[model samples]
Structures are given as C-alpha cells and as structure tokens.
Target: MEVMKVLHMNGGRGVTGMGDSSYANYSLVQQKVITMTKPITENAITQLYYSTLPKNLVIADLGCSSGPNTLFVVSELIKVVDQLRRKSGHDQSPEYQVFLNDLPGNDFNTIFKSLPSFQKKMRNQLGAGAGPCFFTGVPGSFYGRLFPSKTLHFVHSSYSLQWLSKVPEMVESNKGNIYMAQTSPPSVLRAYHAQFQADFSMFLECRAEELVLGGRMVLTFLGRRSEDPSSKECCYIWELLAIVLNEMVSKGLIEEEKMDFFNIPHYTPSPSEVKSEVQKE
Candidate 1:
C-alpha cells in the first residue's frame, strides 16, 4: 500500500463522546505524549524568544492530527511566548504565524472549525495585549520540505517521527508479521533500520533548511530502551496484532496472502540509532 495515500488517523468526531475509533475520540495516548513533553516544549520556546525575539514568530506543528489536541498545542505555545513577553516587560508581543502541518488526508476542516472559539478563549485569557495570531494548515509529509527557506522560528512534533515514509522494501519475506518481530530475520531488521536512517536524515535536512538561525525544535517519538530491533517494548503490540491476524487466517476468515502483503510503516528506533542519524545530519 502507498502509505502516503492511505495512512491517516480515523477522522471526524465519532459516535458518542470520546468513546469511538475516530482520532478525535481515541487520541488520549497522543495527548498524554504532548503533556509529558510540555516542559521541553516550553523551555525551547523560552530560549527562542530570548535569543531571537522575532517581531513575527513563525511556528509550525508538524504532524498535527485533528481534534482538541491540535489546538491545545497551538494554545500552549502562544501562552508560553505571551507569558515570556510579559515577564520581559516588553511593550509589544510578537505576532504569531502558526502553521499546522499533517498529511493531506488529515481532517483539517475539523480543526479550522474550532478556531473561532479558540481565538475567543485566547482573547478572554490574554486580553488586548496578546499579539495577533494567524493560522494556516500545510498538507504534506514532513519527510520532505514543506516550507520556504529560513521561514520558521520554532517547530514542534510529538509522537510522529516513528512513522516511516514507507514500509521498507526488503521486508517482503517477513511473513506472518506486520512489523519488526522476534522471528523476523536479521536482514529484515537491517532493512527497517536503513529506511529509518534515510528518512530521518532527510527530515533533519529539510528542517535545517526551513528553520532560521538559532531556531529551536522539540521532537518526541517512540523509541526503545535497547538497540535490538525486535525489543518487546517496541514490537510487542504489533506482535499481538499479528497473532490475532494469524488466528483469523487459520480460521479462513482472511486470506493468508493478504496478511503476508501487509506491513505497518512504523519503526521505533533506539536512542543511539536516533542520535547517530541526527549527528549525521
């Protein structure tokens, strides 16, 4: 499958409140990741403001999925920068040009519909002193360039980098599995790692070209505690899903060939692996 064409979180609000499979309803885990990384995000923004203090701040949230969490991030960033301006006794806060980027298939309309209320809340909280904020949605993959050269001042992404641009081509022999697994051959593991390195390097290169000097980026994504590609921490959930799919195949509920052809375009790299790629870039 072409992941870029087909992969996206379930869009729109689901049946009942926050109980169904829609991304808006079922993204608690991603929200938690945003909360967990709050400190890092705040710190980066603080430093960026103190260092550059651009009169017009351009911030992009890459891989920003639909729902409250998307706007939550935008709100938090503005709050931090606004608070910093007040603390510094600056007479004028920087104007904000916020960009929300995700796959073209994302539910951008859902996010846009909430902007009026979000702007009203910001006005109530920050009053007339808050800088004017403009929002635009950029639809594309972050694995390639998505903005003009040296345009962004701050960039943030959480729980996104783990998604590969595509499934590694050499893993076709990885039958009975949809991801890296304990039973996967050494060659399969190598192929996955190579794909990650290439994709991540390109990601860094594109971001480097886009961010202005001294700009900051805080990225948080899934990673394993060990270098082992099939470590349980990274692969156990997929392994369980594979087990269920195998059972269905046994019962003739689904074709084995179909299962064999499927593989998730995701990879949870170890810290060292990520560090190496970053350094290379």
Candidate 2:
C-alpha cells in the first residue's frame, strides 16, 4: 500500500496540528508509546530471550519513522535482551540484525545519517559484550512480506497501525470531514472499517509468516474505547481539524470545495475490532 501524503509532527517534534509552535519535539508522543507498550515489550523480551536465547536474533520495527524515535524501540529491546541474558545465566550476547521498515518514500536519508552516531551510542551503552548490531532499512508496506520466513524473532511498531493500507473507497462522499466524524454517513464508516480490517489482517498474516514459532510482536496505535467508530474519543481530533479547515475556508485561505474531498486514510479500531482481527488472523 502507498500513502498519498506524508503527515508528521511539524519539524519532527510535538503533537500534530497543535498551535503551540513550541519547537518540534516527540517527548509527549514518546511517553505515550512507552506507557502503552513498554510493559508488554519488556515481558515479550523476557519470554523470548529466556525461551531460547538464540545466538543470532533478528528484530524489525515496522512503520519505523525516521527520527530519534526510530531507534527507541530497538535500543530498548537490546537493553532488555542484555538484562535477560544475565538473568538466564548466559555469558555471551546475541548478535543483532535489525530491520527498519517503512514506506519507500520515507525520509531514509536522515536515518542513514544518524546510524553512525546511533551505533557509537549503542556500543557505549551496551558495552563490549553487547554483540554487534547491524541496522538496515527495508522499504515497503508491512501489509505484505518484507523478510524471509521465520527470519524475525521480535517485531515492534508504534503509532502507525491507525493508518489504513489506502483510503477506503467512496470516502470522497464523506463531505465536510477529513476523517471519521459524527457527520460521516454509515457507508463512509463501513468503507473505512473494511479497509482497516483488510489492511490489518494482511499485516498479521505477513508477520505471522516472517516470525518464528515463538516470536513476538509489540504493536501500539490509536484506538477508541467505545465500539462506535465515530465516537468523540476517536474522531474528535479530526473534527477539530475540520473546524480549523472550515475557518480557513471562511478566511479565503483555501477553497471551500477542497474540504469536501479531503479525507485522512486512518481508522481508529475499538478493542473488540482489534480482538476480532487477531482472532481471525
């Protein structure tokens, strides 16, 4: 799947669409990511490392955006493995092969530039016993296979699953809204849900093929607490953006018609929806 646009924090920092202009920073977002997934990630690492401390371990971060956060998950995983090794009575560290996957259009140059510094830091922090880390970029949509079968032991993805493989068909009819909104018609909601199901299922299937039998994947993304797809908790942020766009149209800064066809290719699945997908997959 392809992303028609690249939407990211302004200048690689704060939350999107906030007026703070408060210098770019991902601390807030990073905190949420860690809060939601750190425990699970830690547990998964413990289990994986103790279960079979493979001498050579392979990890991939799907939808790994380019920035400081790109290596955050990898760094944490490495540390966990190191600690687990000690607890498991192992003396030698496992060799690491990390693959960073994102769309082909991602800003890979920045990641490549940061690799030298990242490697140096890892070396210092993880020590000589920390086996060599070979980081490589694998550009592609994670909805399909990007690695050889059973090649990956752990996979981590954060702040990405909300994005569908592509925009749902007939979403152009979702006028006056850029994403799921209270005003969106039933058909629009169905289209979005269907697209999410298809995309997420493909993601699971592909990962299932790539991971070993006991491999683990830690994924975190936006989701609604309520079952309703258009619940305010999920769609309110887009609603706020729509309000801003309407104001822009009133000020003649953009065309009124432009808002009619603009829609974000994102879907916030409820817990049940996620459970269903996992069970089905």
lDDT for residue 56 in candidate 1, whole number 0-100? 97
Candidate 1: residue 167 lDDT (0-100): 90
- Best of the candidates, lDDT: 1
- Tell me each candidate's RMSD, in Å, in order: 1.8, 3.7
What would the TM-score be for candidate 2 when compared with the true structure?
0.89
Q: Residue-wise lDDT of candidate 1 within 148-183, one digit each (tens)?
A: 999999999988899999999883588999999999
In candidate 2, position 147 carries an lDDT of 96
lDDT of 2 by residue, 62-119 (tens): 8776666777788989999998887767889899999998877666666777788888
Show the colliding residue pairs in model 1.
Answer: none
Clashes of each: 0, 3
- Residue 226, candidate 1: alpha-carbon lDDT: 90
TM-scores of the models, in the order given: 0.96, 0.89
In model 1, the worst 10-residue window by lDDT is 12-21
lDDT (0-100) at residue 173 of candidate 2?
A: 82
Superposed model 1: Cα runs more than 4 Å off: 14-19
